[model samples]
Target: MTTLVRGRGWARTHPLAVDAVLASAVLVCMVVGSFAEPNGEHGPTWGTRTPDAPSLVLMTLGALALVFRRRAPWSVLAATCAASIVELLTGQPRAPVVMCAVIALFTVAARTDRSTTWRIGLVTMTGLTGVAMLSGGPLPWYAQENLGIFAWTGMAAAAGDAVRSRRAFVDAIRERAERAERTREEEARRRVAEERLRIARDLHDVVAHHIALVNVQAGVAAHVMDKRPDQAKEALSHVRDASRSALNELRATVGLLRQTGDPEAPTEPAPGLHRLDELVDTFRNAGLPVEVALGQVGLDLAAAVDLAAFRIIQEALTNVQKHAGPAAKAEVSVVRVGPNVEVTVIDDGPGDDKGDEQRDVEQHTGGGHGLIGMRERVTALGGSCSAGPRYGGGFRVHAILPVTTAKGGTA
Candidate 1:
């Protein structure tokens, strides 16, 4: 790519050198034409010598300035115009010198403001025509030949300014197109960064909850190993199931990262409120007493709201299973609160006894980020959540979610 860019830069530079050569060739032809009568009626007179060397030298210098006109337009125009004035006063037809000056004028017009071009162009034409007519010995006041020189100079200046305007207008259009393309690329990058952040949040939420459950069950198996081997085996089985389920969900959540031609994604439906009964049955089979109370909310909420509510309850219950004692009983409730739906999970566990909730929170701070994740999800959807000890003797988690999702869908 670097080599290709360097090659293209060279290609763009070569054309300017070609243009300079062509302009010099045109000036040479104009000087040669002035040596004798263009109609061939008065060939070079032997007495006067064929068009003297001084006039030819001045015209060559004026054309030489054309080489730098694109890079330094104003300097080239001043040089060429000065040379043309010298040629006119020395009794030589100065048309070739004016050709180089006209080319430089067009370059300045295209590169600078119109006011500067107009002021300089008018001054050059008026001074050149005045010298051509009034400087020589007494002649007819309205000579046709002298008037033609004045008219042609004015037309040349106007034509050069027109070319300059067209080039500038084309350049302005190209610049706007490039700016619009850059803006589109910037927007695309911003969206990709946001998607990566969401994926990280989901991964953390899934891993923290399941791993904590596995740790709790593993501890149970170790404690009962000597007293009862059969109970230890059942706890180990639960631990294995929980780990495998976590891996599957994590793989599905990060499916967007898969490269092209990878295996097809899973077509199974994501777990939502409809799976509440089944989730509760799993706890019942694991020797945890759980009661679910589902109330009839007036409206059918959007899919994102339903999914967020289900995950909130699932994480809350998972916390109860890990921190609450094996014999603890949990009450899960879902109720309608005007335009929103509310989910509450309450547990009567040892962690709540003797007002040790604050101390337990401090001790388990490193392992439990579930409450933080739950709050983020709720708040992101324009809802609210609070988790703390209940009135009498338990820990309760309450969440209220809007009926319509923020962008109208789940992540």
Candidate 2:
């Protein structure tokens, strides 16, 4: 197989040399056959026993025409056929000159479509056979020479057509395999990108939610250090708790990216709507007044929708704590309306002109990626989220997630 591949590569790179070798082989065959006659001594006495100078010249021209067979198949066939016809008309005995025409005919069939092969093959077969049977010696119409020419030319055409068909089949299979490979590569890339985006969203939610609480508590500890030492110590303790929780959550999030075979990572389930109370308490301890209201809704929500809802609420309250000032109060509500579950987080903070300006500056400096991440998560799960300033004051974030019906109940 290796040798065959190398030979094909060499032939493609040095086509003229390959053609020269073929021309040499054909010249040798014709030269050797010129000295021999058909039917031994029992043949009818007709044309010259040996090839004359003209016959030799015709034979050489026909054989040499094959060197350009691949470059111009039809032209090569025409030249070889013309030389053979001249030999036939001049009463030359059966010789290997016809072999060159047969080779040329095969090249034409191999290179061209089946329709062209049929037309040219038929013309060459009929013309050469007719000439051999009628113009030459006193051989009969059914003579072996004429029949042999007919059979050889027909076989050449059929063989060449077969080669052409096989080549086309191989080429088509190769093309389809390449296309499939390319499609698989593109699909793999798309999956990797989606996985990276999901990890990014998870990291953002973990860091923003926990770090925001830590920041607020640390500020409280600093503000009360002189006047109220007891409250300052309490605040510092809350900051420690918040930081520990953040580290744990960050570890869990990072663990998700580890190899499946690794045994050191945590196996805890991801945070979802069930963790709403814990999430609310974290912000409450950070000194932001938070109220939670849960409506009648099934607990069997799909994991993805539940996680998205939880993250959206988490991010909204984080934004409130950051932008709504220390005097802000936040309200969170989860309710079921028809086939969807709605989550709303609203802050009754100062949304005055000065607050709006600061918020705008924060947003411009890349503080708004939390909202964008929330929207992306909701949209991915066939849900919708909207966030903006409220009518009178403060900001509100609302999201609705579809409850898909499952085998046992709605999910």
Q: For residues 55-112, what per-residue lDDT tens digits would candidate 1 score against the true structure?
A: 7787778777777877777898889878877877775443446666666666676677
Off by over 4 Å in 2: 1-5, 40-48, 260-263, 352-367, 405-410
Best by TM-score: 2
The digit string of per-residue lDDT tens for model 2 on 1-411 reads: 999999999999999889889988988888777776776677644343677788888888887888889999888998999888877778456566889999999998998899999998999999999988887577788878789889999999999999999999999999999999999999999999989999899999889888888888888899999999999999999889888988888899888788967868887788989999999998888888999999976788878878888998999899888888778999999998988889999998985566667656544554667877887887887778887778888888899888763323357
Instruction: Report the C-alpha displacement of residue 234, candidate 1, in angstroms.
Output: 3.9
Supply candidate 1's per-residue lDDT for 314: 82
lDDT for predicted candidate 1 compared with the true structure:
0.72
- Candidate 1, poorest ten consecutive residues by summed lDDT: 38-47
Candidate 1 Cα misplacement greater than 4 A, ranges? 1-11, 14-23, 36-50, 125-188, 228-230, 254-256, 283-293, 297-300, 320-333, 336-339, 344-372, 379-400, 408-411
**Candidate 1 root-mean-square deviation in Å:** 5.5
